[model samples]
Target: MSTPHPHHFRPATTHADWTKTDQYHNKYLLSQDEALEFALKNTDANGIPLISVSAAQGKYLYLLAKTLGAKQILEVGTLGAYSTIWMAKALPEGGEIISLEVNPKHAKISTENIAHAGLSSKARVILGPALDSFPTLSPSPPFDLVFIDADKDNNGPYFAAARKLVRTGGVIVVDNVVRNGRVADDSLQTTDVVGVRKLLQMVKDDKGVEATTMSTVGDKGYDGFMYILVNEGI
Candidate 1:
């Protein structure tokens, strides 16, 4: 008998499987918290796109910030402040997070959500294009962590701007980079894909930062994040 393709021996997993796994992990790994649930519910009630990170992903961001002892955070997107709330909660007593949102509606809703989470003291939502807001932050302390999750077309610009504001040894994370693995295919010239490709090339060419990408699958489906660490020499 001829040998079968290796695929024949492996079990196939579907979106349902990924979702179930995410739920399973959330059940055991996350604790009940009213503020976080309210953030999700309020965002949906306000008709904001439910594109914020999943519960597991939010917790992951929280843990990352907590582990880094991040005192200052700069967030490029503040959709409903879901992820913002998570990261803000990880800050120290005097730590602060400045989140930027281009949509006035989103900025308003996120501001409300942050206040509801009792994190208004730790987080602030700035309404405007991130590029416009970046200049205003020049006088502030360098951010220890930066999260970029806004328009894909501006990914390159956002990364470049963030690199300048982040402290040496700081971390910068870009979300939704893989786009279901389309990033590797040059034939796909979608703006989002093209943006990610360009950002990847920029990172590869930059000697001041060390970076890596991680593929993820959950209730939100397949996507990935890019993590870049600024070198001390820079």
Candidate 2:
């Protein structure tokens, strides 16, 4: 075996530092409360994949929901409900949030965490493939915001459904689209990256939505989210 590169030793540490500083800045300037802290602990205790959005990202979601005055929100992934709790806190009185999760264990823990946050009345965790659950979700009032954070391999389908479920003026946010910058390379055809590219193409082809993608570097390493705004008139 060849000798490992010296740069490999510092990357993880450097990434951790990046996340720490990002979190500190967000927390010092903004604030994340204890409920989010307990939800993170719940995720760890349940052995769920610690893949929930970072605190800063969670706060961003919360603020976005509040800014939108989102009455009905949909989350495509409910991993331990850390982000779920954050977004749910933005709901107005009588507002509701529906979170979809494929893993029953994850749904169970998400339900527990949401309840622990005193949001059970406003939030519900559905156990099923998001594709399957989407059909049953109502589009009556339509979702003011839809957050897609599930399996990246199905992002195209999720966005397609989100378009149908969101109001004309609503917003859709798909996370982890950048995947450490792999998304910029056309030769790499990983399913996750391919799905994101397909979704980008769909957005480009559809004139009803205005969309943009942004890259982020933090504790989650390098990744990004796509923000799509649905405009009136298809």
Candidate 3:
């Protein structure tokens, strides 16, 4: 083992600190939104899991889609449509996003939330497994951005499908890849961690894409996203 750099070594930040920082950033950078608040409240009322992206992360997704001028987007999961609404709000007229949800309850609630956000014209939630929906998406317009946040155990398959669905120069984002840092520990072989590892290995062997992992610490604890840009020439 190599010696660690003394100046770089430091105690890990606590979850409380991480949450405080997220709150601070959200208060200053993310303005209050009635639609989003309502969606969250409705989700809670319906007993849906509150695993949607944080405000800061949602804004990041929004900005990413806006920056790309994405006309078509695909989301592998639609939990209450919180993130869907965020990204949908960034779309221009005629732009559309299709979100897939395996759970009927989640899909129904997501549809309602999208309508509540006044984004019904731009965002649609499909009730079905993402793998099944992927096949039906063919022959349609290629997606400019694909966000995969569904069951982690199927991440490798999701990435493979996303590669075929997304257009050249498009981006694919896989969330919760770090799984509280368990992904890197050999002893931690949870299904989620193994799925992420498999996706990483596939990305490593794929020469047609450029990809990187970004580790994040926030209210959601330690996790990360794997971002891949499809470029056949690369």
Candidate 4:
């Protein structure tokens, strides 16, 4: 787990957001109890599961998908299958989450988790780098939502790919946008921070895309993620 923020800056130990808790801020949505339990159980035993997107982050993305009436979604990372379940559980009937995982072993575990959640049909685990598998989906379905939570170095390229996959009204969310609050400070030299900075710049400068970034403090740290809401005439 790569924690960019220290303890002093962490999100309040108390997660006030119902969306982040094991409970849901909204009804008609599956309680995250089962999914979160699965993540905690697997994360501690599996090591690096330490670096996963918080359950709050996953729930936030899931809520956005539901709001957008997303029928097709593409996720760049499927760590422990926690996020995969979050996204899949929120989909409308026939909605699907096509998640990408770099490691075959991780993908296998995610497959089991998805099945355990009874969402096997709603989610498809892709076993490879997103860059490799993403481009292969010729004439891809118009993804209504795209979530990027994998390697930080490829944010720009992934955003480019995400843009192509999503429809005009679709949304693209990249986790870890705050990068421990390092992005705002130009002196930082870490590759991940720099990469995120570039992506933010892209979002700000693009005229064709309209976006709004929400800044928040959470239990993890001063760091917060951003969501790029793409309104391609939608």
What does candidate 1's lDDT look like per residue over 132-233, in tens digits?
988788725688999999999899999998888888888999999999889898899999999999999999999999999999999999999999999852
lDDT of 3: 0.91
Q: Write the per-residue lDDT of candidate 2 for residues 35-99, one digit (tens) a residue.
A: 88888888899898799898889889999999999999999999999889989999999999999
- Candidate 3 local lDDT, 82-187, one digit each (tens): 9999999999999999999999999999999999999999999888888888888862568889899999999999999888888888899999999888999999
Using alpha carbons, what is the TM-score of model 3?
A: 0.93
Flag the better candidate by lDDT, 3 or 4.
3
Once model 2 is optimally superposed onto the true structure by TM-score, how far is the C-alpha of residue 122 displaced, in angstroms?
A: 0.6
Q: lDDT of model 3 at residue 108?
A: 92
Model 4, stretches more than 4 Å misplaced? Answer: 1-32, 138-140
Say which prediction, candidate 1 or candidate 2, comes out ahead on TM-score.
1
Question: What Cα-based lDDT does every candidate model obtain?
Answer: 0.93, 0.89, 0.91, 0.76
For model 4, state the Cα shift of residue 106 in Å.
1.6
Candidate ordering by TM-score (highest first): 1, 3, 2, 4
* TM-score, per-candidate, Cα-based: 0.94, 0.91, 0.93, 0.82
What's the CA error at residue 75 for candidate 3, in Å?
0.2
- As for candidate 3, its clashing pairs are none
lDDT of 3 at 186: 95
